[model samples]
Target: MSKNNSPDSIIRDITREFNTIVDSVSEESNFIHDRYFRFAFADPIRMAELLTLFSRRNASLKAFLDTIDLSSLRGARENHSTDKHIGSADLVFEVDLKNGGTTGLYVGIIAEHKSDKDKLVLNQISEYYHHLFLERKKDVPVIAFIVYNGEKDWNPLTETHFADYPEFYHDIGYPFKAIYLDVGHAIDDSEMKSLSPITLVALTAMKYICAKAQYTAPRSYRQVHLPLRLSA
Candidate 1:
């Protein structure tokens, strides 16, 4: 039991360490207005630490890679200046997964941190997903995840898809799939138990702060729940 708890404790410790790393290396910070975003993606080294922390904390994501292999997995923060939006993904990179030494491939995971009180994250995630699609081929599985630290209890209203957004009227709008991981929705240990390792890592990351200040946190975790179901 003690050994089992060690990793979880380590995850929390790393969160503190990451905070320190960000404070020391971040170019600028405004805790009252941009506390969350500053904590997550402002520093490249902090971002790398976060990726490692999440991957290690979640068993499923860890199982997917079997072990950490920096030679294959690389993470970075890209400046995606688009006419459609102002913010870019907090973390973006290729993760190479080896399945029984027979199959090895790299899949992309785009992570966005949302920690505000507003619920306008749907549009942000939709835009990011579409942008990813435009840059990558259609065959590429660019999985999306939005981590939020506010509110709970969600049932996604997906029938009203991103197209329904009033701002995305033209052909410039991109379409892509996303998985929502809402930390607020984890009301109890059971729901947390139902969450996938990827989702678990996402939630753990969100508990700290948002990746960008421009985006609003969704009402719940409805946006990125697919990865949890897929992991199951």
Candidate 2:
């Protein structure tokens, strides 16, 4: 397979189907709510569930990447030490090829997901990228993505745009691509039909969270922190 962007048709169908399933699942689980879902440090279980969902999506993403020639597709690894704040992003992931004992192969990605408001994950991704830089000993091509399940449109207020956030000041040696995976966008009828189960779960969580976040306590970015361990 070649490394091509997902076909527009595929993207649309996947998004559409996913939205349908989420609506169905939410109804069955009685997961529908109107309050904003807060991703505080106190809610570790939700964080773990979110991480597991993301890892599952990463598998799908890898398959999508394979269609475009990306090799050595692998699973996700949560970097507990690299959480955005203390409880904001559930976890950061490192997805890469099977390590071949090479010093600088530059094949992995660093990612974060949020189900809460009040946290600037774009800035957080920047911080995590730096952490990876120090740990990996190389910029190593990094792809950063955020699965945001917020209700209202969260136009990023930072100097960071989704396409350029983590890569804003990154060197050419360490290329990065940032994308915002909006759950709302996933359920839009025009785009939800082809979404995989993993993406559907992400959107469902987003729907529930966004519904809950509206009335929750305001979360300060500085105090945001990811959990130390992922839930089972």
Candidate 3:
């Protein structure tokens, strides 16, 4: 458990780390974010919190997430053979079926974290989704998510190569839902105090872009901008 629980500082640290790595390192920043994101999200607790928040918008998935055992998040891996590695983490789990009584199987929930620079690789992701179904026998629910954390960028769905020829892959429906969780938008000032300690600390490590100060100061003193999500 980390000592720092402040969301503001955490958010700042995330942006700083990402920007620093991209600016200084020889390697493209994708691998760095992939490793960092995997470690942070692999922690069942943090993953649960965000999923809980996401469940607010979805009813069926909400029910599934309620009893989900975070201990089952296997690990993350990226296929680096391609020139631009569109890294994705693997989250597999199986829970008791709400509909099926005793014969229920363990359902797999594969979540792919899409960062700022990541393009939409529908073919690759779709292929991976199929592999999970065929290669590994698992009841993959409709709850798989493609978490898009990039604020300003192209949409992963329409911007991909598949856009050119929809006729070829019209039958195969995309398995995962595109859930946007961009950190570019700061939390409202009024809602900051009410945030959970875990959420505050975890979100920074989750996904966030470095933003400019939104406020200005008075004449005599220098402008001091407080963090958007104040730690209570």
Candidate 4:
């Protein structure tokens, strides 16, 4: 493989690119934020790393992440259904389970990026789940995540009412509960220190760009970004 095409090189390049963008931005753009969010997680390895880090906080998710065969990670096909009600997920991945045996079993990880608050975001996520369920024939286990970088405090689960009949809520499971990561509040300096380069850059960029006021990267992050930029 070419030196520049190596995984290490790729991570550095992405970090540098993110640094360049975040350093120069004067105003926030949802489009730019969404694009960068998708770009950072486009690589299966990077996506896996981010999810694995996130799984550290949730025991059940960590167990599931441990079962994944990272080598088998790949981007899932984009939704092309003409149905107006259905929504496409920002990033979706399919990875085989380590104990799948001869037939091979896989699970889906869906990530949705939010640059702004949307009360109906869960509805959109539900649509994505429905679409994936139809395409995968409901056999694949799916886990969903919401990466929110908006300035406003928003929690879809607590803010939105899922159903009128609370009793029937447990019965309807088409859309799984998403683990919400509010970039502004979820990550801290201690957590940042242990993150992989790609995860560090991605989360740092999101936190910096989405802040209510002008923000600066921590000294450690700047030190990390410098080497990446020099290498790139």
Q: Which model scores highest in TM-score?
A: 4
Q: For candidate 1, report its TM-score.
A: 0.43
lDDT of 2 by residue, 71-118 (tens): 333333433434223332334433344445454343545545444453
In model 1, pairs of residues that clash are 179-224, 180-223, 180-224, 180-225
Query: Which candidate should be chosen as best, given lDDT against the real structure?
Result: 4
Better of 2 and 3 by lDDT: 3
- Pairs that collide, model 4: none
- In order, the Cα lDDT scores of the candidates are 0.45, 0.42, 0.47, 0.68
Question: How far out, in Å, is residue 195 in model 2?
Answer: 6.5
lDDT of 4 at 65: 69
Clashes of 3: 1
- Counted clashes in each candidate structure: 4, 35, 1, 0
What is the full ranking by lDDT, best candidate first? Answer: 4, 3, 1, 2
lDDT of 4: 0.68
TM-score (C-alpha, index-matched) for candidate 2: 0.42
What candidate 3 gets wrong by more than 4 Å, as runs, is 1-28, 57-90, 98-103, 153-162, 166-171, 175-180, 186-199, 205-232
lDDT of 1 at 96: 58
Q: Candidate 1 lDDT, tens digit per residue, 13-46? A: 3355344423422343323223343433433344
Per the 3 Å backbone cut-off, how many clashing residue pairs does candidate 4 have?
0
Of the candidates numbered 2 and 4, which has the greater lDDT value? 4
> Model 3: which ten-residue window has the lowest total lDDT?
215-224
lDDT of 2 at 208: 43
**True-vs-predicted CA distance for residue 225, candidate 2, Å:** 34
